[model samples]
Target: MATLILAQKATSLAYGPLVYAHYLQDHESDLTVTVEWQDVPEITVGGDKTNVVLRIGDIQVVGAANAVHELAIMSGHASQYTDVADQLPHWLDFTRNELASGDFKQLGQTFETLNRHLTLRSFLAGYTPTEADFAVWGALRANKIFGGNMKSGGAKLGPHLVRWFTYLNGLPCVAEALKGHQRAVESTRNRVDQGNFDIPLKDGALGKVVTRFPPEPSGYLHIGHAKAALLNQYFAQKYDGQLILRFDDTNPSKEKMEFEQSIVEDLRLLGVAADRTTHTSDYFDQLYQYALQLIEDGLAYVDDTDNATMREERGAGIASRRRDETVAENQRRFEEMTRGTDYGLTCCLRAKMSVDNPNKAMRDPVVYRCNVKDPHHIHGYKWKVYPTYDFACPVVDSLEGVTHALRTNEYRDRNPQYEWFFDALKIRPVHIWDFSRLNFVYTLLSKRKLQQLVDEGLVNGWDDPRFPTVRGIRRRGLTIEALKQYILMQGASQNILLLEWDKLWALNKKVIDPVAPRHTAITEQNLCVVNVLDCPALPEARDVPKHKKNPAVGIKKLYTSNTLCLEAEDAAELAVDEEITLMDWGNMIVKRVQRDPATNIVTQVDLALHLDGDVKKTKKKLTWLSMLTPAEEPGLVQCMLVDYDHLLTKKKLEEGDQWQDYVNPVTEFKTRALGDSNLHDLRQGDIIQLERRGYYICDRPSTTESPMVYLIRVPDGKAKSTAAKVNAPPNA
Candidate 1:
């Protein structure tokens, strides 16, 4: 049980702890908290405010989710809570310290601070709403004006902020805590009245949760794209809904049929099934009509403003010269654009929503633009103009009867402009749910930069093992189950993060370790031959389990003979007469030492079988392949092994840094190896473990020109030497 006492006048400051405490209480956790309001004092000692103090069985906490978080940690859900320091930079202090300064202009700057932070996040502190969220929303709820605006949805206060604000305010504890604050309830009255935006269901009607996964087929799908695709599938299945695969191929300049086909194939590999497939270009005529109607209603106009001048005017909030163009002029210019005329190519249709609008997205934004450069993949030269995402998304979503629209919050700002189309077109509005886009450290997912790499030959191609594209990583040996698990774990987290590749591959290792077939691959350079003095005169074959844990995988023959080969590194580690276990063949004592002194390379070794010695007692267990073949033995498979390092040296690419400067000079490593004969039958894309080495993917089976098999290195949660080391002599 806990006791919470806050200044009655500053109950708003107590929002987080009070709400969190109430939440645990309602969950029937062995948790009870009694909250009482008191008078706030001007001075707080040691930064502990008496107005918002919590006593959890004698442990006193001052602010944030301190009490609740400590309890969560104790309950074994440590990752569920985050540090309160992160919440300090939020709107809570802005409204208290800055807004209270009586400078109304400060609100804009405050919103900007919170807005930038929210650009890729749904919560204030972490993936889930922390105590910081509850506190901020609570304080905002107390300010009758902000609270009232927060509930209305798409508040000018900040769309991202409002999105999070409404969601948090709707939680059971939040709803219960704000009971006395009528404005908050009334403002958010529309939220519940309409329905939960997160889980949209038709009102007084029956229908599946129809959703869509829209991708602009400009480039191959990368690792970051998997989250969006997987989440859509997850929600659709959870609700027994239909997921539509829609190609937002509005930009003909970049769209291609090849890319479109590759996207479909990629999703198939990821195991994403769609109930229906669609192309935005299919609704070209409808979008054109919507644009005409908007122009006819004086809600849009044709702008001849050049790109540079238009950007300058927009930044300065100055109206474009054509803002007041006649509807006839707009219609004519629009027709000319459709015909691919010179005048049409220079002009674009812009929404006449506002010139001095506070929200920049609503400030007469571009709706239709001429794209006479490249033909649409599906429509050829039939249409010369294309509708921007801002205009096409809402219109198509409504026409297709989409119940929910899930997208990256990077587009959060343009949301108002999106819904405005539906309202103006008098169509049903689809619920918008934005999740943060995925990003990785030392990697760029931008298609333009990726294309630059291809053009400059910085990497092999789209499927370069170093690239993050689905094909690239698959080539690098990422299993489907691993990709699925990674996506599911990060589902709907609005926090935009630049994560390390370590955790991702760490999860991948868990999926592969138990089932991966174990095989042996010895390095070719400086390969050492061993003379087994007491070896069998006549070669004999013994079968060994492919995977020790699961014998059901079957077995392979371990050929034995008087002659054998061992890796130079293993041979170098042996001391004359030192006993070592020749794995699967009992112990052997090294008798003779052979080396090329100039390079310190071991040439050969003479070993006498130590059958009586305890195999466990040996320090090193070396894997050796017999050189003499059995009667029906097929020779070991020759293969090329490939590995990679981060393409960029910089951890995070900043705006000022030239990316080329950070390009890692050496990022790929290759070595020749001899694999077990079983590798000869394995097809491309098979993943296997090389004992004492690393996991590898078969990039190419033995072919006509390249008689040797090709394998790519797979990260198995182990640190590896850099690409530069591959150039050095073996074991240097």
Candidate 2:
């Protein structure tokens, strides 16, 4: 267990660390912390004494900031404390230098800055709280002047600050920390409960609740499958129960070992570890016996109705001709099916639940089908007849001791049929809970459609950036953390919603923005060369932070020379003597412009350094790369920046609409660009930002075989103009 030593009469500066430690102990099961009070004297304002000390085994940390950092690291939650890793030290310094000042005017100014920062964001660093919040909140709570101001309506402290403070203060951990070893007070604030994420199961018991994720091993797991798997894992962990990963591999013609392996790998990537893995085929013999029992009990019959007529009969609420077949004859046909006889190849076993039930799903649903051609991937021709998902699911779930069957609402109509099997077999029944299916507008979640796209070469493969598979989105720059957080936020809402892609990508932006390294790339097409008249004769190089707000992301070498390259679009908008800011560099004035007289394309321009000019006053902020100097030429790295559009043009397809008719004619787009020298060091999968452009992931690095580096654009969940666009051809 981790131990935290604090002064008996701790000061406000130590409360943040105390609260953070308590939070870890409560939320992180692996980390157990015991706080020990000591008789150490409280440090004065300018004293050089540590108020908080944390010890984990042999690791010891002194001071409030270090203690929080140590606890976060020990609990495997350092990311929460370092979301703004680059600027954390600067913010920590602000808490010490400004907020700790005795002057009331200086303290007010500090609060004003913090209030404005919180205006558009919930936390100081990222979407979630960081060490900056912990330190700042502690400093503010310690100040008597700030406390008095908040008590007196907080008019002078600013409303945003007050709102943020109240929210943080109400948290259970924070409340407990303030009470100093006392029990936490229950929150009384009324919040708009959008939907309950923590869904409680009927008769759910700790260590006994069991859940299962049954995926058909026909294709790669898509985002929809991801939601189901995650929810099952979430419930299982919530109840301290076992989670089973079961593959519904009854359809051998479509299922494959490769797909099953991929599903396992994807689940592992999503942080879902099943307690046990099994296949529906593992109980084939048992299922066959169950079917025989149903036939003997006259609960099921053999039907030879053709595919078209069977659908027509079910739709018209008409009984099949074989509905009254004798039990002995049905038993003979089922035995023939198991033996792969040609006569039984055309027959299927159906449950005789209803002839004209209001619910069409109960109208003699097919329970067993004959497949004599393709050998089972696992069983390998051991049996010719296979039980349908409807017959196999409930039996296997009960056999595996699953207590709750969490499934998508699309199966809600068949819930009764599922329970019917349990009653017909006189076995244990599993509770059924239906949550809405995850559907994205303009996206296809059907495995058959996705496979068609691959077979026709419409996409690279399952991992194509345009596809919605788990691997596809990850390649497209969607972090696993962002995906999990987004899904959990949706929870188990019963109301089905056709969600837009922007909301998910927007959540991803919050995760990657703070850490993605920054670089510069100028479009190679119609590029204009600019001569900086006042530039130094020789090239100058300086090391600058890759991410402005995050110094911990490290630095990149930026070079400046007399000649620079600029995108023609920015040049065309410039007027004679117009002032513009050159991104990382200082402001410059456009002195001259030269264009191709025939096409009006920008060809060449002249600029003069205006370092003293106010960058805020400049209307245009452009990205430029230095080309050459009097000493030597440092050529820019060549890159192919690729972007994509939705696979389908339509936002939402209707029931009868042919999806192929709505397929986007030009979903893939490419643009040639010249990037900064720093891009040359980028390896595959490195996510970086091209200044004035959006984020991108390195798909391929420059090699002897392929000279140009390949970078795929990452969506920023912004308007079309701000993200990657399809202004050029596929190979441009």
Candidate 3:
């Protein structure tokens, strides 16, 4: 390998050769040339500013007049360094030029496109440093340094690329380069770190608020956890307080590195990257000291009673024999327990709270447990003892300077205990914010249940669309904006409620409908044959918007023919001479209706133009497809027109009732359909509202060329009140 050395300032100029080499290699050209180092210009511009010159190696090159000042070395046979100022470079330069010119509109779009392709975690060459990574990083920082209207454009540059960008940006190395770039920093801020924290200053002065998102990495985070993360994050950002992401991985048995990593990823995905991401394990020594201080202060003790006996003793409002153990004995046993020498035979650490407290969690809960097994995930058999999450959480929060502690209402009872730990340890007080947990119907968010489903193959995995996992929802075409908006709508409330699926799906639709592309399909209808009056072979119709608002979203132009087909139901009641409106076109007349004699069902329909000049009045205009010019061949879609009467048949099921008996037989209906060519191009996970057919997502792509499988639903169909329909205004 030879070297092409350029000065540090000329690094940008070196980009051309490397890219050209790669491009040539891609084309299977093995042409090799050695580039030796020499003095070069700091910045090189477009060709035509230099003169012919030859160097010591007889390399044919041109030297520009006054180019020495500009570092332009040219060759007589000099080929323009076309590679340097090409498409990718032009985009980069356009971004830079736009930033300089203050044309933010164009700059924002270009940067958004670049951001989609570049990310921090991405490896430069191949998961490691490469010239491309560094170059892209430099250009991206310009947007950050010189402010612009920054927002994610819902542009996805593939998962590997996404993960790469995320990882690179999160690295401690590039953090310095990202300084002064508020948008970039905010993008990386952790969700749970937002909170109102008040630190106490000197002379009885109150300081600003700080908060932390402390997640126990024993299971995957659900929407409830996501809500807490976002609330804390919002508060932190609002208050300008430090947000910390701490892993309360105290119990090693259930916790794993996998969960820890996923918790970090989940937080990042939710736009929650705290000011600092620290772990409880990182402060084990301090936590241990705190525990010892509580024991020494006579505020905690070692309980040697077995689990069943201890529960019985606490429930009876009686202190166990171990509770009465002297401080010296308790301290000795705690040490022994920590060593795992007398673990099972010895005692566990418990905060000495009231036995008669109504809340079971307050009744001297155990703060530490001993286990001789290998470390579960991170520690990996390194320690024989672990602190409980409840015990470690407050300690770490205070130690990390966290001001506000936020969690779901489920922990309301334990809030006092959290306070007790701080009081007993003589630590600073942290404010607590309680909010309701989110519950979605038809899905279980319990980790154990989800794990069972995964283990038993009831669902695919964590990312299974059938499951309510974050990745699952994302894969199902739900956007981060939608998730944030939905959670915000739920608001922070003390009142706990079981959220209806209808409301959640409605919110989801609201976000996705405005921008998702529109394609046409119908259930129970195999083809749409549009009848035209000597229709042109190729009719050019502009793409129709999925949404009337939002012009940035793209649409498709559907072609029509003389024998366009409409849904069976749409054709069912059509009478001769009746007028029906075509969606994109004007009115058409129902010339005739054909029915199958054996089945006695509407089999087909014939139609003629119900031109506005002739038709005076009409009702129920419907959509149709032209059979003469089918963009996509017939029968390419397997449509499921899903209908759910209720999640449960009965209004409510008794505790012991056979609820499974109420499973709605007609919960879903599947049929075949002829879709446009554009519909055939829909990838799995694309959500589309079939015209008058309801909203749906493509669950699986078609194995054959023609038809795809679609899972769809009609909003508010089952829930719509008949009374409301009867009383509705005429137009509606």
Instruction: Estimate, for each residue in 11-30, the C-alpha lDDT of model 3 and write its tens digit.
Output: 23332232323333333233
Q: Across residues 1-732, which tens digit of lDDT does each residue of candidate 2 receive? A: 788777655555577678887777777888888877655465333345667778778876777767776777778876654546877778778876888688988888988998998898888877776767877787787788999998889999888999988887888988777676542211211111123558889999999999999999999999999999999998999999999999999998999999999999999999999999999999998998999999999999999889999999999999999999999999988888778788888899999999899999999999999997898888888888999999999999999999999999999999999999999999999999989889998899999999999999999999999999999998988889988877876788888889877768888889999999999998999999999999886788888999999999999989998899999899899899899999889999889999999999989999999999999988798999998632453357899999888888787999899999988878887899999988878898888988878999999997768769899988887767223233345756
Instruction: Give candidate 1's TM-score.
Output: 0.72
List RMSD in Å for every model shown: 18.0, 16.1, 23.2
Q: Local distance difference test, per candidate? A: 0.77, 0.86, 0.59
Candidate 1 residue runs with Cα over 4 Å from true position: 1-208, 356-358, 719-732
Structural similarity to truth (TM-score) of each candidate: 0.72, 0.72, 0.62
Candidate 3 lDDT: 0.59
Off by over 4 Å in 2: 1-195, 536-538, 629-634, 721-731
State residue 641's C-alpha deviation in candidate 1, in Å. 0.9
**Residues 283-314, model 1: lDDT tens digits:** 99999999999989989998888999999899
| Cand. 2 TM to true fold | 0.72
Ranking by TM-score: 2, 1, 3
Model with the higher TM-score, candidate 1 or 3: 1
Candidate 1 residue-wise lDDT at 464: 93
